[model samples]
Target chain A: MAESMTFLDHFEIWLRAYLILSLFSFLYKDNRFYKLSEHVFAGLSAGYYVGLIWQTVIVQQLINPMFDEGEWVLIIPGMLGVLMFARLVPKWSWVSRVSLAFVIGNTAGIYLMNALHGLIFKQLYATMGSISNSNGFAGVLLALVVVVGVISTLVYFYFSKEHKGVVGVTAKVGIWFIMIAFGAHFGFTVMGRISLLIGRAEFLFYEWGGSLGQIF
Target chain B: MRNTLPVIIAFLAGIAMVISFFFNPERTVLGTFQENLLQWVTIVGGFTLVLGVFSIVRVNARAVSRRSDGWFYKLATVISVFAMAIPSIMPTSANSAFGKVFYSIFPISWAGAFGTGPDSIYDWLFNYVDSPMMETMFATLAFYIASAAYRAFRARSAEETLLLITACLVMLWRVPIGEALLRSIDVRIPDYINMFVMNGFNLSVQRGIIIGAALGMASMSLRILLGIERTYMGKG
Candidate 1:
């Protein structure tokens, strides 16, 4: 596979190898190589967004519809977008509020409905359904655990009343459930990070190292 | 006027979106209005990126001019930004007037196309430079996580002990070596861990948290719509 590579392919492999090494250098200690690669990464990522937004949002969504398709009403949003830059000017900074408010309000409206329907109701229905759907003895036990865990967790978060009597007991149980959940989450995150580490290691060892061996 | 007008605009925009959710798009203009509003928001949102790019350029340019400690790195960033952006914004087709001029002026035969397509400068930079760095950055976190686990994974209380046990079981279940070791003890142990600890306890707690969070989000959104959450509108 290394022998079959073209000049551009070789160059790409070598460049990627260099960047990966440069970034990994941070493990040893921060140096000029790492700093250079870090800055370059930031710039390229930001620039990538520039091209993406220009092509997708500005041209495709705004300009094309307004001019070619005769959807002139889009100018209102276009003007609103331009208003965002008013934040740069001191006296005229207040002018940007209209645009900010629109975006915020629109997002808030979407989130409110989504939260009520998508999250709260769905979760409640799933919790109730799990109980009925249990199969055997172990299934029933697990389903009971789920029911207890959820109720306790919610009781734990509820701070309206002081932690005494039944509320305190439920809250204590909630704390244990939360701790277990957090531990599981931590383990999951570690595995994910380790997988990413393995990926870079594989690329370095197989692609870059293999190429070097072929060359020598 | 500055304060009141924005609040009104927010209320109206929010109300329109909420109202649009109920009506069928096929039957009413509200559907069309909703679609337009979403598109408009996206277009408006894109400009924020422009603002971001401008800010990056301004700050880096100022630092470079002052010859700050890491000015050279800052300069590299600014150069990288332009190097990636300019070619991506250019026309890809060699037949086009701009592309003809650009290719002739630069004369890089290897670059078969332009814009954000394959074999372009932007794509090349993204593939080789940006992506590897991002992967390496994330990969580096594994080390920090190990150090953190060593410090924080102590079993001081019942809750902490439960956490440690759960974490240990999960970590064992995840890795191939650990799973094999567990299987050597009892083949069903790994499955039990998956069914009991993960599906039972983890799922339930997560659902409860989600419900709590959704309620919080709904309340916050209501506040924003009612013009009570003016904190988003920065102080004058």
Candidate 2:
């Protein structure tokens, strides 16, 4: 056992277990350690994203043009970025409006071109095919179930307020269909979450335990 | 006025966007419009970042002025944001640079490097750090569930007894023991008293729970959208 497992390996495993189990301790009651861990996690994540945006977008999109190839088109956005500083000043902050419009327009432009191809139109086209295209009998049933589930779910949100009478009854039934689907989905999610915890626990038990754990 | 105007603009922009998808307006025309809008989005988003950067500047400036502890962190953060943003377009690493500078970063295929550099740092963080943490956060529901079961699974009245019985069956069926104890773990209709009946019951029960959960989520989202729920905004 000692031969197979290094001391550092054991220490690291236990460290993860301690952090995870300590996080779980918040369930019993709020505590300082949980807060500390949560805060650390937040700060870490924020820094991480900013790093990514820097690497992926800012560097690729902005700085590369400035330094690397001297592509002046990139400088337009750069100038616009500088223009955004208008917000800092009292009278001239409205100068940022030009910048804001550029951002909105660009996003709308991209999404307008790309989003429908992947999401709505494409998805609808795929689902329009026969249910047999689904893998098995169960899969076909599941597809049908999903369609009905989605429709019913939508009905549950039919909040025009005036939607009552006969349609109201149908809407209520839709709500039930949606409710059942949601409940089943929740159970699945709960199982998934529990599975994650169990997986972590297994890591602690098997990985951290010793060479005996390695054998299995 | 600050928030309201943006919301209105977003709404109008969204409506045009919806039309653009189906219409497929002439490329030369739409492309120009789209290009113009893309530029606008980039600019506006950058300006928005100015608000963000200014806030960062304030804290750091205050810190530098007051000589506060950890002021250097604020300084580092500001400097890093700038460094990362500048030459952000530059080839800090091969993957980062898009144009010709990116093309010549190295002869070796980046795939060979596999797990290195800023991209890899992000990939690693997301996989190991973010995924596990998210899973861990999700896993925490087990404790709440257990406590709820303990208190809620009591059989005080007839209704309670019925509820307890169903919940117990559900709990059993959910675990490994239920299939083991019932005999013939495989599918069969041995008796209405036995396997088939229980399976049907369990399937329906699970299905119902799934639908309820989805509605719960939808209700919550709708509430937030309608301004009925504002906890996310921090203090209603």
Candidate 3:
């Protein structure tokens, strides 16, 4: 299967090997080689995105309206964007404030709705749904346990007074529940991290290493 | 007044995007607004990211000038950055031309290495290397899980003792051998306890954890959007 190679073929092969090997170097250490590759990776990605934006915003959105379609609606946000450039001016620094206000108000309004509908309503719905198929004493006990767990965990955040009565007992149990919960989560996270490492190891051992890498 | 405002804007826009998915589906304008805002924010983020490259250039330039132990790295970084960036910038590189030329050679070359052709290098890498690597990594979790159970399951106090008992029983119930052993213990106990009681309870607990994590992530994400936390912005 051996064949002669051209100059550009050798150049491409060397480049591919380099980029692959350098990326894998991070597994060994966050050394200079890895840093070099990381910087290249980051810069290339950033530059590409910027180019895409220039095409999308300038060419598609802005230019199409001003030149092609003769539409003016696109210029509203464009003017606001221009106001952002005023921060560099000596006296017109305040121009960006109005822009900032709109951004804040717009964001707050959206999230408040999400918090109410997505988080609160869905959770309550799911809680009820879990108990729907549950029957017999075990089902009842299980639902009771869930209700207690959710409520007590919420109560654990209450810090108005000395948790001396029922609140204290509930919070104590809540802490236990949370600790166990975290332990479970920690187990999963640990598994995820190690698996990612193994993936890098496999790349180094096999792919680039070729026939030799598969010996293991 | 400063970049801080934009940071806040970016943060809030992220929250808006998430929230829009929930209650604002009827508000088509709001969805469009969030999408537009994020695109603008992304453009701004691109500029900030350039500042990152500039900072790196400054730091590594100093390191190279001072003759650091691995100054060759800074040089390589600069070179590769330029190699990838300059091609996109100037657009006269043979690589780009090569892409254009070979673009028509393969039957389906657009998506990736595999899409290039059946006899492509990418197809071979995908089938023999990348896919296997991903699957192997995912599979490695089984062993790590077994190890974690062995090490973490220790009895010390009342809670610890209870945990140890549950953990061992659960572990035993999961494996086929464990199920066989449980079957020999008592047919009804294994069926009732292992299948119905333990399995059902564990599933519920996991579901609860997932829900809790999702909520926490959303709240944290919201806080970041509102500019309550500026951790993502870095030291600058």
Candidate 4:
């Protein structure tokens, strides 16, 4: 494989290795190389999106359909998109509100239905079903824990009332559950980060380093 | 008219979306209307990215021109944006008029250098430069997380103790070696932690949070639809 590798391939490997090492340089301390890599990354990522949206949204979706398929109505959205550039002109900045309002309103509409049907109702139904649907003693206990946990957690967040009675005790229980949940989340995140770290380490050792040995 | 017109447009657009959800697109015009609205939203959304890129360019270019601190780095950023973006937006096929002109000016071998293709400059940069940097950046977080854990995992109070214990068990249960060690002590220890802590407690708290967030979202959406939430429209 190394014998067959071309100059472009070798260059690519060297570039990737350089970038990875430069980024890892930040772990020890910030340096010129790390800052350079960081800025390049930011620029490249933004540029990638610009090209992507231009191709995918403007050309493919809007221009093609308008010209080829005679979907002239698409001009409305195209015009609306152009209106967004009005922000560049301070005098006409308010003109961009029409575009902003449409996007926000559309998002709000989607969220309203999705939240009501997709999340709140489904979660409530699943909580109720978990208790009645328990098959064994362990299952029942788990279900009970869930029920108690949900109620207490909700009670903890209910700050409209004072926490001086049974609500106080339930709120305390809620805090315990929340702490445990947060701990679990933290553990999960650490596990994920470790996995990513191992992946970079493996790539550095095997792919980059192994290539060097093969080439030599 | 500037304010009132935008508010009205928002109400109409929002109501249309809500109504379209209830109707089947296959049978009704509302479906077609909904699709068009979504397309419009997407196109408009794309322009927001263009706006963002412009902002980046403007800020960096200003810094470079002023020869401010880190001006060289800012110049690299500005140059990078154009280098990556210009090639990506160029016509890929030499058969096209623009592509013919572009290739005549540049190298013919640079045909189809649009970002999506396998051999494109965009793809090459993304694979070699962008991706490696992103992965390494993310991997760096592990070090910070470890340092944070060392500082934060102290068992100061009962709640803190519980948190620490839970975090330890969860971390232990997640790894293969830790799971094996737990099983050696008692197989049920891991099982109990998974069932009681993860599925039961975590699930419930997540559910509560979801419900709370959903309610808040619904309320906010209603406010927007009613034109009561005009903050999105910016101040006059």
**Candidate that would win on TM-score:** 4
Lowest lDDT sum, 10 consecutive residues, model 3 chain A, at A207-216
- Residue A139's lDDT within candidate 3 is 72
| Each model's lDDT | 0.87, 0.51, 0.54, 0.88
Interface RMSD for candidate 4 relative to the native interface:
1.0
lDDT of 4 by residue, B7-69 (tens): 888888888988988988779989888888888999898998898998899999999999999
lDDT of 1 by residue, B1-236 (tens): 98899899889889888898888976998888888888888888888888788789889989999999999999999998898888778765455565588778776564454578777787888888899989999999988888888887799988889888888889999989999999999999899989988998999899889999999999999999999989988989
Q: What would the per-residue lDDT of candidate 2 be over residues B1-236, giving only the tens digit for each residue?
A: 44334434444554455456665556546656655455445534644543564566576667867878755555554554443333322343354435446547555454322232544544544444444555567678776776676676566765445445544444444556664554455443123323222333333334334444444544443343333543322211
- TM-score of only chain B in every candidate structure: 0.89, 0.40, 0.54, 0.94
Q: Candidate 1, clashing residue pairs?
A: none
Give the TM-score ranking, best first.
4, 1, 3, 2
Please estimate how well model 1 matches the true structure, expressed as its whole-model Cα lDDT. 0.87
| Candidate 3 Cα outliers beyond 4 Å, as residue runs | A1-105, A159-163, A201-206, A209-216, B1-80, B89-236
DockQ preference between candidates 1 and 4, better one? 4
| Candidate 2 lDDT score at position B28 | 46
Residues B176-231, candidate 3: write the lDDT tens digits: 79768988987665566543334344434554554565566557656656667554
Ranking by lDDT: 4, 1, 3, 2
lDDT of model 4, residue A20: 86
> CA shift at B206, candidate 2, in angstroms?
16
Indicate the docking level reached by candidate 3. incorrect
